[model samples]
Target chain A: MPAPLSRRHLLARGTTAGFFIVAGQWLWLTPREAEARVFDPQVLSPEQCKALSILGDALVPGAADAGIAAYIDLQLQAGDESLLIGKYLGVDTPAQTEFYRAAADNVISLAGDKNSMQTFATNMASDSLSGWAGPPASYVLFVLRADALDVTYGTPEGFERLGIPYMAQIKPDKPW
Target chain B: MVSKNCDVIIVGAGAAGLTLAARLAEGGKSVSILEAGPERKLGDLVSSQIWARKLKWSEPAVSESGNHKIGHAFNAGTGTGGSALHHYGVWLRMHEGDFSLSSDHGVGLDWPLNYEELAPYYDQVQAEIGLSGDSVKERWRPQGAPYPMPPLPLFAQSRVLAKGFAKTGRHTSPLPLAINSEPYQGRPACHYDGWCDSGCSIGALGNPLAVWLPRALAAGALLEHNARVSRVIRDANNTQRVESVEYLQDGERKTMQADRIIVAAFAVQSVRILLSSATEQHSAPGNHSDKLGRYLMTHPAGTIFGLFDEETYPHQGVTAGQLLSHDDYDEKDAAGGFGSSQWMIGHAIKPHDLLGYGTNRPDIFGAELEPWLKRASRHLGNMTVVCEDIPLPENRITLSDRLDRDGIAHAHAHHDLEPSAAARCTQRMSEGADILRAAGASEVWAGPRIGQHHMGGAVMGSNPEESVTDAFGRVHDTDNLYVAGPALFPSSGAVNPTFTITALASRQADHILSIN
Candidate 1:
């Protein structure tokens, strides 16, 4: 038998690796690694993932690199067990998948020739995008921005980046 | 269907239910608690805000409507400890004037009992589960015994925020909390890591998992997790008594018989269970007067954020804040608004999550976001304004047409803040911003108003025609049915409701024991 994993070792591993399906097998990998490895998303389509990555990165720099799309995709597939902040914003888990899908579709529909992504984000924040459809653009922006922050600055590593102490009494086994 | 019998049956394993279970079981009555959520242990409470979402209400979604909706998904909780597990331990007592809202001010419903009647229970609960605070500093506090432990030391953030109160000529006190300041009753002292919102893993915080669950188990009270109660079944022969409770567990429908029943499932779910108990021969146990789910209330609350010049280290204390200002608490009919209000200052906060600085400002993003977040982490100071919610008949919990997979109807909450209450909240938030500016904040902003603590769905009152339950939380028109927790509160005071919820359950336990 392999050596038993100590509590410290398990915590260390947990902080970095989240459960993800890679190549028809369940494996522990960071969201960034999962994104780099092109893990199949169970809920969001490839096009939807691309849109989410672009919009999320525009909302918070480094969000795409932090794997915001993979993170949100995993949460959406979790159904009632989803840890997405949208749950607290009155969007139940059953509705979250559709909310994100529609929001991403609207983002995709925004003609690139009409405005830059940053300009689109600015309009989205103000609810001023002329042809924007689906759930209120400002509300979607808020939720997506919150999601980006969660993926980027919501963990111990993220705390270190911001110069704040994690100070966890019981560290999370899964970052999300 | 499997069936079990107990002397007393409680519908929830929250603060109120566990308190009753511990007390009643210790009094030699066989007790069984049915919790709708899964079991939770101390080790299960992780420190990440994202992970903490597991502790919140998840399934059988409670639909909400109207302006200023109750925010049920955010406010309510699931699992063993219920909402109390993730609560920020801001234990506060309702003022004497709060009990007499209708009698004194000709507005809202009045409590069946007054402050003096509930004072001893508050004192008892404080002693049982050690509270830390300087009562002498809380001059607005109603008559009660002093806190058991000295107040937790204030950090730099509170020191800076207290200066703002001083400059504004408002008195501030150590916020009374149910967290241990030092080693108390075998629990260690709080590490002041500011993860209270994520559920405290240590025994320092007086969550049900830390305080009442052990006592209840030791006293022979059996707890059933994932037992979603459908309704209370009235006896076929004796219509006035609730003989058995029907529930779903592990994909099986089951029933449990008990001599007495108490619905302690927080505010909304408790009322939902009772509302589901309606029969063709009789109205719901407390709905004879069409008042079972009426008078729903939630504190109209908002937070004011400021960017300070000094190194505040905003994440150095508890999430509930370090200092409190009740300077404007007593005068309900004050110039601007109708009800009482208080300020919880210097909250230990994070850069992410719902209430975090990063999420609060959706305007700044891309290259600008990270730099701002880093700065706010060090300099942000925030305080929440909690204002009393005027209980209205229209603000209620009703059965929604939507059904879950189990065929049980979902609960729907509709709440619109009264104009006067909204006005009061607006007035206080403006004042809070001014106070922050007075305290030398370089910049100040306020978050949107949201509902905080919930109360008053199955309210307790002197008249059965006017209320759902009597003073002892006994459901009117029923011999052995009761409602506990914030559901028994007739008015939503500005104060946090957990302390009062525990005290009311303590009183109900004593009353039930005496009758037995």
Candidate 2:
């Protein structure tokens, strides 16, 4: 019943949602919608996504449910057009996939029990984690935590939850 | 392999390029502007921080290395309005002493001309753009015409923050901003929604899209988006004159011949284009004296946050901040440190993102963040501290060995904060925390100091041997070549550069029209 979305509509709304493979067809959807549908990530591996979701949720509560992994995976697939917070934090889009993959591996390696994951997060924040490889643990922790924040608390709904006003002149159509 | 010819070709469509394009085209010079980014309209100025990243510089990533990186990707922007599209509208003029830094303080490079010479241009540009402020309260403001409109209204956050300045024996004045306070020049008044950094969509903010783009288009100036200019080509007959500009557009190489050329591609990219143009026959357009990409500068700025017991909703104002204090700005040679500093008080902020309070306190996370964020949403007060950067020859933009898909070299910016400047920033941040404490903050914290605005690289000066461009932004060795934008700034004056950049470009436009 809805007309097909136009480029002008997307620009006017400033949607952060992207196209994802749903039932073997490309569908424009929000990261939360993609996560609910269990859409396969185009760039990150299943193992990597699982690791990221677990660690991201551990870093910020409800991040996994808010689709942090799907949001990151979708942004990574966008390549140079990625709008992830990492773009502003010195990690360019071309190098983002590798950064996330290595960081996910590091998170998976240290994550075990709930208490252990919490300690690992603390250690990661302080850059004191043992056997941490790839980018500095503190920097990776900061980026992943920021990504989680983006998915969990950066939308109008999230602003409502925090008792803050989302007084947008041009509101985004979808919350990524 | 398309070729086009025009009387004037500007290699950017930002605040500087658009200002020049509008003036030159209206002056009867056929003008064409080549923008590297995609076309953008007022509708494209979205109100989300995540979507706002699309306005920033993305690809052929600039390689940065130094103790303090210039933050090229974050500070620079793409699309029609360029970086000004996402700017916060903090328009402050450089003090008189800022012009003669070397002459007065014996540090940093001095502007070729004094504030007296540039004051008229500043007045002219502000009138065209329409600034809002209480100039009488801004006692530190240089001799110039008052702002066109009254300052934007103060909110609870600013009212709470002003008490701190008063308690600390400092004065606070309404921040001079390019955002409209009322319906001025047909633009709507600001809603004070804290969306300035996400680009003002309602034309309340005086971005190029709202001020000059329409004027340029009406004057018959041509604008080409996604035209990535590689370099300017010197004429075979006259090495001192640029004949054409080579660029990539729509997957094909193109050439645009023009009688006059202006590189207004921000600071880093403007320097990069000149650096890439070097050949055996001639040095880069302004590099004959080896000062093409030297004296790179960015303001060493950071934010100070406080948790107040009073209910202070921090999101009811424009993002730039409500009040300003320049009490310590004029004293460049003070004891504990060197150079000027300012306080942009009571910034409207979000819960997340880089400058957000949540991100500043990286230690608080997991179950602890939400409650803290909910509390701070109604009880937080924050302000930014901007300190001057001492221009150093070693902090420069140079061509990198790595090439893009088009074989164009990447720009590598290296900048390290001077010891005295760093000391000054540190000292002021400490004072800022004390001010917040004096206002009865339960807890206080400060964000990491980072590079704010980019400037210099192709600095303007009187001596051709010591600087890249003349006071009018003409390249020393070229008759038709000029450089615009903040790239021509010889010193970072601890104030926002957009006003100065716009004023300087207006003066350049006048000079160009007069000569023709």
- Would you estimate the TM-scores of all the predictions? 0.97, 0.97
Give a tens-digit lDDT track for model 2, residues B1-516.
324488899999999999999999999999999999999999977788888889999998998999988898899999899999999999999999999999888888889999999999999999989999999999888999999999999999889889989998999999999999999899999999999988899999999999999999999999999999999999888888889999999999988998899999999999999999989878888998889889999999989999999999998899999999999899998987988999999999998888878778888888888999999999999999999999999999999999999999999999999999999999999999999999889999999999999999999999889999999999999999999999999999999999999999999999999995
Name the TM-score of chain A in model 1. 0.84
lDDT of 2 at B390: 96
Model 2 DockQ reads 0.70
Every model's Cα RMSD, please?
Answer: 3.3, 3.2
Candidate 2 local lDDT, residue B258: 88
Question: Tens digits of per-residue lDDT for model 1 on B425-514?
Answer: 999999999999988899999999999988989999999899999999999888999999999888988999999999999999999999
Candidate 2 chain B least-lDDT 10 residues? B1-10
Clashing pairs in 1: none
Q: What is the Cα-based TM-score of model 1?
A: 0.97
